[model samples]
Target: MNDFVTVAVFDYPHEITVLKHLLDQAEIDYFFENETMMNIAPMYSQALGGIRLKVHPEDAETVREILKKLNDESNLKIV
Candidate 1:
Protein backbone atom coordinates (compact mmCIF):
# COMPACT_ATOMS: atom_id res chain seq x y z
CA MET A 1 0.00 0.00 0.00
CA ASN A 2 3.06 2.23 0.21
CA ASP A 3 2.62 3.01 -3.47
CA PHE A 4 -0.96 4.10 -2.91
CA VAL A 5 -1.74 7.81 -2.85
CA THR A 6 -4.81 9.70 -1.71
CA VAL A 7 -6.96 10.84 -4.62
CA ALA A 8 -10.04 12.04 -2.76
CA VAL A 9 -11.40 12.62 0.73
CA PHE A 10 -15.11 12.10 1.38
CA ASP A 11 -16.88 13.32 4.50
CA TYR A 12 -19.33 10.44 4.73
CA PRO A 13 -19.69 6.83 3.67
CA HIS A 14 -22.97 7.60 1.91
CA GLU A 15 -21.09 9.96 -0.37
CA ILE A 16 -18.93 7.11 -1.49
CA THR A 17 -21.55 4.49 -2.24
CA VAL A 18 -21.69 5.05 -5.99
CA LEU A 19 -17.99 5.73 -6.13
CA LYS A 20 -17.26 2.37 -4.59
CA HIS A 21 -19.25 0.61 -7.29
CA LEU A 22 -17.60 2.66 -9.99
CA LEU A 23 -14.14 1.82 -8.69
CA ASP A 24 -15.08 -1.82 -8.50
CA GLN A 25 -16.40 -1.84 -12.05
CA ALA A 26 -13.20 -0.30 -13.24
CA GLU A 27 -11.15 -2.82 -11.32
CA ILE A 28 -9.11 -0.07 -9.73
CA ASP A 29 -6.83 -0.90 -6.88
CA TYR A 30 -7.90 1.32 -4.02
CA PHE A 31 -8.94 1.55 -0.41
CA PHE A 32 -10.73 4.00 1.82
CA GLU A 33 -8.64 5.12 4.77
CA ASN A 34 -10.48 5.92 8.01
CA GLU A 35 -13.71 4.53 6.49
CA THR A 36 -14.29 2.16 9.37
CA MET A 37 -13.66 4.85 11.92
CA MET A 38 -15.85 7.29 10.03
CA ASN A 39 -18.66 4.75 9.88
CA ILE A 40 -18.35 4.32 13.60
CA ALA A 41 -18.34 8.06 14.18
CA PRO A 42 -19.35 10.21 11.24
CA MET A 43 -19.03 13.33 13.36
CA TYR A 44 -15.28 12.74 13.54
CA SER A 45 -14.84 12.97 9.78
CA GLN A 46 -13.54 16.50 9.96
CA ALA A 47 -11.15 15.65 12.74
CA LEU A 48 -9.89 12.57 10.88
CA GLY A 49 -9.59 14.50 7.63
CA GLY A 50 -12.42 12.63 5.95
CA ILE A 51 -12.39 9.15 4.42
CA ARG A 52 -9.49 9.01 2.04
CA LEU A 53 -9.75 7.29 -1.31
CA LYS A 54 -6.32 5.87 -1.88
CA VAL A 55 -5.34 4.32 -5.19
CA HIS A 56 -2.16 2.80 -6.48
CA PRO A 57 0.06 5.42 -8.08
CA GLU A 58 -0.28 3.72 -11.45
CA ASP A 59 -4.03 4.17 -11.36
CA ALA A 60 -4.19 7.69 -9.99
CA GLU A 61 -4.93 9.41 -13.26
CA THR A 62 -7.52 6.87 -14.27
CA VAL A 63 -9.15 7.18 -10.89
CA ARG A 64 -9.19 10.92 -11.22
CA GLU A 65 -10.85 10.66 -14.62
CA ILE A 66 -13.42 8.33 -13.18
CA LEU A 67 -14.10 10.74 -10.36
CA LYS A 68 -14.47 13.57 -12.80
CA LYS A 69 -16.97 11.69 -14.89
CA LEU A 70 -18.88 10.68 -11.78
CA ASN A 71 -19.08 14.24 -10.57
CA ASP A 72 -20.07 15.58 -13.97
CA GLU A 73 -22.76 12.97 -14.40
CA SER A 74 -24.36 13.11 -11.00
CA ASN A 75 -25.57 15.57 -8.38
CA LEU A 76 -23.46 13.70 -5.83
CA LYS A 77 -20.36 15.76 -6.38
CA ILE A 78 -17.56 14.35 -4.26
CA VAL A 79 -15.33 17.35 -3.88
Candidate 2:
Protein backbone atom coordinates (compact mmCIF):
# COMPACT_ATOMS: atom_id res chain seq x y z
CA MET A 1 0.00 0.00 0.00
CA ASN A 2 0.95 3.69 -0.12
CA ASP A 3 1.58 3.55 3.58
CA PHE A 4 4.83 1.77 2.92
CA VAL A 5 7.63 2.75 0.65
CA THR A 6 9.14 0.84 -2.23
CA VAL A 7 12.32 -0.19 -0.53
CA ALA A 8 13.61 -2.76 -2.96
CA VAL A 9 12.57 -4.78 -6.01
CA PHE A 10 12.38 -8.53 -6.63
CA ASP A 11 11.97 -10.63 -9.73
CA TYR A 12 8.95 -12.70 -8.90
CA PRO A 13 6.94 -14.51 -6.25
CA HIS A 14 10.03 -15.99 -4.62
CA GLU A 15 11.78 -12.68 -4.15
CA ILE A 16 8.61 -11.06 -2.91
CA THR A 17 8.07 -13.75 -0.34
CA VAL A 18 11.71 -13.84 0.65
CA LEU A 19 11.79 -10.12 1.32
CA LYS A 20 8.47 -10.28 3.12
CA HIS A 21 9.70 -13.12 5.28
CA LEU A 22 12.85 -11.22 6.09
CA LEU A 23 10.86 -8.19 7.11
CA ASP A 24 8.59 -10.36 9.19
CA GLN A 25 11.51 -12.01 10.95
CA ALA A 26 12.96 -8.61 11.69
CA GLU A 27 9.63 -7.20 12.89
CA ILE A 28 9.71 -4.61 10.15
CA ASP A 29 6.29 -3.82 8.79
CA TYR A 30 5.78 -3.89 5.03
CA PHE A 31 3.10 -3.82 2.37
CA PHE A 32 2.99 -5.56 -0.99
CA GLU A 33 1.14 -5.51 -4.29
CA ASN A 34 0.63 -8.99 -5.69
CA GLU A 35 -0.99 -9.01 -9.07
CA THR A 36 0.46 -12.34 -10.05
CA MET A 37 -2.57 -14.47 -9.29
CA MET A 38 -4.83 -11.50 -8.97
CA ASN A 39 -5.25 -9.29 -12.02
CA ILE A 40 -2.14 -9.57 -14.21
CA ALA A 41 -1.46 -13.14 -15.17
CA PRO A 42 1.90 -14.53 -14.01
CA MET A 43 2.09 -16.66 -17.14
CA TYR A 44 2.44 -13.46 -19.11
CA SER A 45 4.83 -11.77 -16.67
CA GLN A 46 7.79 -13.48 -18.33
CA ALA A 47 9.50 -14.14 -15.00
CA LEU A 48 9.29 -10.48 -14.05
CA GLY A 49 5.53 -10.26 -14.07
CA GLY A 50 4.65 -11.20 -10.56
CA ILE A 51 4.08 -9.82 -7.11
CA ARG A 52 5.51 -6.56 -5.84
CA LEU A 53 6.80 -6.05 -2.32
CA LYS A 54 6.56 -2.58 -0.95
CA VAL A 55 7.72 -0.94 2.29
CA HIS A 56 7.00 2.36 3.93
CA PRO A 57 8.67 5.17 2.03
CA GLU A 58 10.37 6.19 5.22
CA ASP A 59 11.60 2.65 5.74
CA ALA A 60 12.67 2.19 2.13
CA GLU A 61 16.36 2.93 2.66
CA THR A 62 16.43 1.00 5.92
CA VAL A 63 14.91 -2.10 4.40
CA ARG A 64 17.18 -1.91 1.37
CA GLU A 65 20.27 -1.56 3.53
CA ILE A 66 19.23 -4.51 5.62
CA LEU A 67 18.51 -6.61 2.56
CA LYS A 68 21.86 -5.64 1.07
CA LYS A 69 23.65 -6.58 4.27
CA LEU A 70 21.89 -9.91 4.40
CA ASN A 71 22.73 -10.61 0.80
CA ASP A 72 26.34 -9.62 1.36
CA GLU A 73 26.68 -11.89 4.38
CA SER A 74 25.32 -14.83 2.48
CA ASN A 75 26.97 -14.03 -0.86
CA LEU A 76 23.49 -13.68 -2.30
CA LYS A 77 22.11 -10.82 -4.30
CA ILE A 78 18.59 -9.67 -3.59
CA VAL A 79 16.69 -8.54 -6.62
Candidate 3:
Protein backbone atom coordinates (compact mmCIF):
# COMPACT_ATOMS: atom_id res chain seq x y z
CA MET A 1 0.00 0.00 0.00
CA ASN A 2 1.09 3.52 -0.66
CA ASP A 3 1.77 5.92 2.19
CA PHE A 4 -1.17 8.23 2.85
CA VAL A 5 -1.27 11.65 4.37
CA THR A 6 -4.02 12.12 6.93
CA VAL A 7 -5.75 15.43 6.38
CA ALA A 8 -8.63 15.43 8.85
CA VAL A 9 -10.66 13.30 11.22
CA PHE A 10 -14.34 14.03 11.84
CA ASP A 11 -16.44 12.18 14.36
CA TYR A 12 -19.74 13.02 12.74
CA PRO A 13 -20.67 11.14 9.63
CA HIS A 14 -22.32 14.22 8.27
CA GLU A 15 -19.16 16.19 8.78
CA ILE A 16 -17.09 13.46 7.25
CA THR A 17 -19.42 13.24 4.29
CA VAL A 18 -19.43 16.96 3.87
CA LEU A 19 -15.67 17.09 3.91
CA LYS A 20 -15.49 14.28 1.44
CA HIS A 21 -17.85 16.07 -0.91
CA LEU A 22 -15.86 19.25 -0.57
CA LEU A 23 -12.70 17.49 -1.58
CA ASP A 24 -14.48 15.94 -4.50
CA GLN A 25 -15.94 19.27 -5.53
CA ALA A 26 -12.51 20.78 -5.35
CA GLU A 27 -11.17 17.99 -7.52
CA ILE A 28 -8.78 16.95 -4.79
CA ASP A 29 -8.33 13.24 -4.30
CA TYR A 30 -8.72 11.57 -0.91
CA PHE A 31 -9.31 8.25 0.78
CA PHE A 32 -11.11 7.27 3.97
CA GLU A 33 -10.15 5.32 7.07
CA ASN A 34 -12.32 4.10 9.98
CA GLU A 35 -15.51 3.64 7.99
CA THR A 36 -16.67 0.80 10.25
CA MET A 37 -16.51 3.07 13.25
CA MET A 38 -19.15 5.28 11.66
CA ASN A 39 -21.67 2.45 11.43
CA ILE A 40 -20.84 -0.04 14.20
CA ALA A 41 -21.08 2.40 17.11
CA PRO A 42 -22.52 5.69 16.05
CA MET A 43 -22.69 7.35 19.45
CA TYR A 44 -19.25 6.25 20.46
CA SER A 45 -18.00 7.03 17.03
CA GLN A 46 -19.45 10.49 17.21
CA ALA A 47 -18.01 11.04 20.65
CA LEU A 48 -14.61 9.66 19.83
CA GLY A 49 -14.99 9.08 16.17
CA GLY A 50 -13.77 10.46 12.96
CA ILE A 51 -12.70 9.48 9.47
CA ARG A 52 -9.14 10.01 8.45
CA LEU A 53 -9.12 11.83 5.12
CA LYS A 54 -5.94 10.92 3.39
CA VAL A 55 -4.18 11.78 0.21
CA HIS A 56 -0.85 11.14 -1.44
CA PRO A 57 2.05 12.35 0.70
CA GLU A 58 2.98 14.86 -2.00
CA ASP A 59 -0.50 16.43 -1.72
CA ALA A 60 -0.70 16.44 2.05
CA GLU A 61 -0.37 20.17 2.53
CA THR A 62 -2.85 20.92 -0.22
CA VAL A 63 -5.34 18.51 1.28
CA ARG A 64 -4.90 20.14 4.67
CA GLU A 65 -5.63 23.57 3.24
CA ILE A 66 -8.77 22.31 1.58
CA LEU A 67 -9.86 20.71 4.84
CA LYS A 68 -9.28 23.98 6.64
CA LYS A 69 -11.39 25.79 4.14
CA LEU A 70 -14.20 23.28 4.44
CA ASN A 71 -13.98 23.37 8.24
CA ASP A 72 -14.17 27.12 8.23
CA GLU A 73 -17.19 27.03 5.96
CA SER A 74 -18.86 24.44 8.18
CA ASN A 75 -18.22 26.59 11.24
CA LEU A 76 -19.62 29.64 9.59
CA LYS A 77 -22.79 27.78 8.69
CA ILE A 78 -23.25 26.93 12.37
CA VAL A 79 -23.12 30.55 13.37
In candidate 1, what are the lDDT values of residues 22-79, reduced to their tens digit?
9999999899999999989999999999999999999999999988888785565545
Scored by CA lDDT, what does every candidate get?
Answer: 0.91, 0.63, 0.69
Please tell me which predicted candidate would have the highest lDDT against the true structure: 1
TM-score of each: 0.90, 0.61, 0.69
Q: Model 2: per-residue lDDT, tens digit, 1-79?
A: 6566555555455566566677888787776565455345656444653456577677777787877777786666655
* lDDT computed for candidate 2: 0.63
Clash totals for all candidate models: 0, 5, 2
Model 3: runs farther than 4 Å from truth? 44-49, 73-75
Give the Å shift of residue 19 in candidate 3.
Answer: 1.5
Task: Single out the weakest 10-residue window by summed lDDT for candidate 3.
Answer: 70-79
RMSD of each: 2.4, 3.8, 3.1
C-alpha displacement of 44 in model 2, angstroms?
3.1
Q: Which ten residues in a row have the lowest lDDT in candidate 1?
A: 70-79
> In terms of TM-score, which candidate is strongest?
1
Candidate that beats the other on lDDT, 2 or 3, i.e. the better one: 3
User: What tens digits encode model 3's per-residue C-alpha lDDT throughout 1-79?
Assistant: 2687776776756666666677788777677777667767767765654666778887788877876775575566531
Model 2 is weakest, by summed lDDT over 10 consecutive residues, at 37-46
Off by over 4 Å in 1: 73-79
